[model samples]
Target: MTATARLALTATLCAFAAPALAQEITINSFGGAYEEAHRKCVIDPFTAETGAKVNIVTAYSADAFAQLRAQKDAPQYDVIHFSGGQEIVGASEGLLLPVTEEMVPSLADLYDFAKAGVANGEGPAYQIAAVGLVVAADKVPSEPTKWADLMKPEYAEHLVLTNITNGYGMIGLLMLNQIAGGSGDDIQPGLDAVSQLLDAGAVVVSTSPEIQAEFAQNDAWIAPYASDYAFTLKKAGLDVKFIQGEEGTPASFITANLVAGRDNVELASKFIDKSLSPDAQACFSEALRYTPTNSKTVLTDEVAADVVYGADAAKGLMRFDPRVIEANRSAWTEAFAKTIAR
Candidate 1:
């Protein structure tokens, strides 16, 4: 071969080998179906495409955050999937990287709310999580149409309350507070509302899956749960439904964030982009029933109701401002802890 041809062939060979030389990325994610979904839709595809290994670490966000915090000076994972509020907290505390659009092209696939609100700011990088209330449709009389109705007499004993320490639990209480004629400014009444429910014999559940299983077995009826768990029960043929509660239940969101300090930033960006693509969005909605931020994704008619940010419910959805929650977290947790003491 001529010198020029030999040089061109060598360049192509190096280009092909570059991705394999890219660094591997480790991600700590919440376990259960989310982990499985990530495996099927993200990690596998990414590794297959680039020949780079992706290790997913499964654990609770709280535990993962604590671990990550401990390793702040020398971070272990190259990407972290955490709650949007937690992401904000980490970013504020200097535990996370401020992701840029250059790292995650998927930012363009996200919806306006997902992009601008809590997750991806304007340009790109992290993604906002989607969350909502999960309830069984048959147990209650009025369908539990709105966030306010959960406080009614019919739902009094039938409802299951999540452990108060969880952020989403506080969101549920905040919704109740708003329904009970209080604003975020005054959440005491919301606490009072939950107090009345507890007094009325509502069950308190510690995990989302447990709450879901109880609902499926008819041991419990309603639950304020994440959208993903809601879909899990529904798939098992339970008579459950997820309503975008009136006044809207707080959407506990997380930004799909990548650790910028990694050597695999390019590959990490590719994985992020593919996961947020329309095809992946549809897969996520159909499999987990979690709403996808990609506007182009479609869902089955049955599932369409449960997807929080689907075409029908996107316009009226309400989400708790994470900043607000973080600001008042201490006071809120203290009040909730007081309720637990009672």
Candidate 2:
């Protein structure tokens, strides 16, 4: 061969022998313990099994949704996780793609409620956190049975009421409203109840960490919070016990969504599918005390005791429509502030 032709042939052969770059997908996760659990449960396992590189952006639900909106035309994250119901608005605004059985094979294995949002172009709920009461067992003489127990005069000064601004607080308020004869449209009864609690000296808080602080340092005897967080308090060395109200425990559904206008839709679908798998679901359940949404996820008796496991167990959980909450959220926030102020 001529010298120039020989050089061209050698370069072409080297190019052909090179391996393709690994597929990469960016995703958002809530920070702190939840992020740690997600890395161990879903992200690490997905990467190991699929050989895809996963990049994590640490942002909570509201911030994550805001980021999605800011990047709607050119999405940066392939998948986004929402603990609140921001997916409803995201899907409506064309920022998220619909989750279908065709996109994710594991969709068929999830509980009916978990798949309820699929028709609305929203993602399926991968995990559920039940909103109930957490009590300092050593401080309270007797166990409380329902949502109304927080109003007991004996436990008046020792209460921690979560504000509606928080996701868990919103669900907690809804549960309180339900038991107090208030519906999504009519929150007066719940407002009246909260006013009474405030008058009785209940301390209102806006975040999980504040609730934990109250239990640990401020001698808070009872608070309406999530089941997962109750375990968190326990792990922190507090004598806390989570109780499902007799009326019903309101639940927060954590969903994983595919970002619209992304180049890695197929890879994102695989990540979502992996999150819904039995092993991943079980890992999350064991690590965070979050209830698994996949029907096939099996938990040990010890872990199951803390979670709302199985279809029959999940059926008893109270679920408010995210659309209703989204619609009334602004007015409800204002009313909640005013109620607590009085």
Candidate 3:
């Protein structure tokens, strides 16, 4: 061949050998430490394995759901995480796609409780955060074993109660209501109990940061919060102890759902599947103290002790229906406000 012809042949071969661009998908993750752990545990490993790029949008559960509603015609996120049970409403309104075992093979490996919402056309829970009591070990006179213990007169003025607008706070309040003979349809009993506590001097906080501040600055002795937050408090040098109220620990299921109408549903499924893998689950458990949803995920004895590990342990967790919670949320919030105001 002539020199020019040979150069032309080399250029054609180079063009044929060029790599295709990596697939990219956008996902919304919670902010702060949870997102940091998610990056290390799920996103990094997913990229390393699949060669797909994940673009993150940091919005908490309620805000993310609102964004989904607003963008229904032009979906932005491929996958969205909800720690606040927004998936129920999202799935109902057709904002989210139904996740199945066929799409995400690891769905079969999740705990039964973790798969509770899949039949409702929602996503499977990737991790569990048990809502329980976190007490300042040095301040509380004794370790609280049940939800009613918070009502003890001695806890007055040193207790921090979360507002119902927050997910953790919502679960905490529902659990209190359950023990106080109030059902989801009837929150009056719960409100009355909270009013009694408020009358006795317990303070109400609306956000996690505020709760942390109450603990760090105000000598708050006890609070109804999640197990994972106990670790956060401990990391901040507070001597805290997590107690799963003997009545039952309410679970906060963190779910990752596919956004409806997204072009990258296949890629999004892979991302969600990666989160349910034993390795990723274990990473989340260690980093954020979130309980692994994947049944196969193994943990060290220390980590197991901290989370709600194993099938039997998971069976004992209290799971409120997200549908019921969403339905009653508005009226409950109003009643809560009125009660607290008194």
Candidate 4:
């Protein structure tokens, strides 16, 4: 072979070589169907592409974060997934590693909401789920196309609502306030609406069981909740269907973060990049009903119709700043509790 040809062949061979030296990483993230979807869509594909293994250890963001803090000196998991702004708190407190464009080159392509500072400068949002109205298809007296339609007397007292303790719950309240001419720091209109709703017989449910029970046993006909959760109900054999109201949807995300002291940083970053890729992002939207952060991901009409998708779709959704939600979560929780007590 000629010397130039030999050099070209060698370069091509080096380019095909593996990027991640480590073969495994421990990950803490969402479980059950969420995990199943992630495995099929992101994890399995990543393993196939990089010959790396992902060990999913189930835990909520709070639990995983506590564990991360407890084991910061010697990290237990290479990566952790957090929802809402919980991961942002961890990032701000220096519990999670600061993710850079260099580590996960895919970061540059993300939606503004999924960028580093969104997670307090520590992580990137790979998946997002929208908040919408979940209706018992067989029920809901009308077509249920608009957000304001929730106040129709037909739904009064029969609707199952969540408390602000749930992220979407706060979104719902803020939505109501906006509908009633209230905005930021002024949920009094929403509070008044809820008061009227409860007086009219609406039910306030906090936990998941309570939500399912209200639907499964109590003949509850309507609810405002996250798309993933509402889809879970649909899968469980309820006549549940998620709908995007005329006002549009509100969404939050699951942030993938690297642990500060993880040993397999390269592998973790590769895994994160895979999760944010078009193929994996599409999988997330298709399988688990989560929205994709990658702009390149395309979804079928059937799939896109259900979850939040597209630039115009995202821009149209009723999203507030994450910092706003993070700043007032506690106070809003207390206010919601007080309002419910009344």
Model 3 steric clash total: 0
Lowest lDDT sum, 10 consecutive residues, model 3, at 14-23
TM agreement with the true structure for every prediction: 0.82, 0.90, 0.89, 0.82
Point to the candidate with the largest TM-score. Answer: 2
Per-residue lDDT of model 1, residues 1-342, tens digit only:
999999999999999987666757788877877778777766787778777787878866677778778888777777777664566666666665544456666666667666563342212322233445566776656676767777778777788887656666776777778878887689888888878899987877667667766786645767877776676787778877777666654665555655535677666667667777777767766767766677777677876776665556666656777678777888888887787565
Question: For each candidate, what is the lDDT?
Answer: 0.68, 0.88, 0.88, 0.80
Report the backbone clash tally of model 2: 0
In model 3, the clashing pairs are none
Span of ten consecutive residues with least summed lDDT in model 1: 120-129
Q: RMSD per prediction, one decimal?
A: 4.7, 3.5, 4.4, 6.5
Give the per-residue lDDT of model 3 (tens digit) for 36-123.
Answer: 9999999999999988888999998889898999999998899999987888899989998888889999999998878877867688
Local lDDT at 84 for model 1: 41
CA shift at 140, candidate 3, in angstroms? 2.1
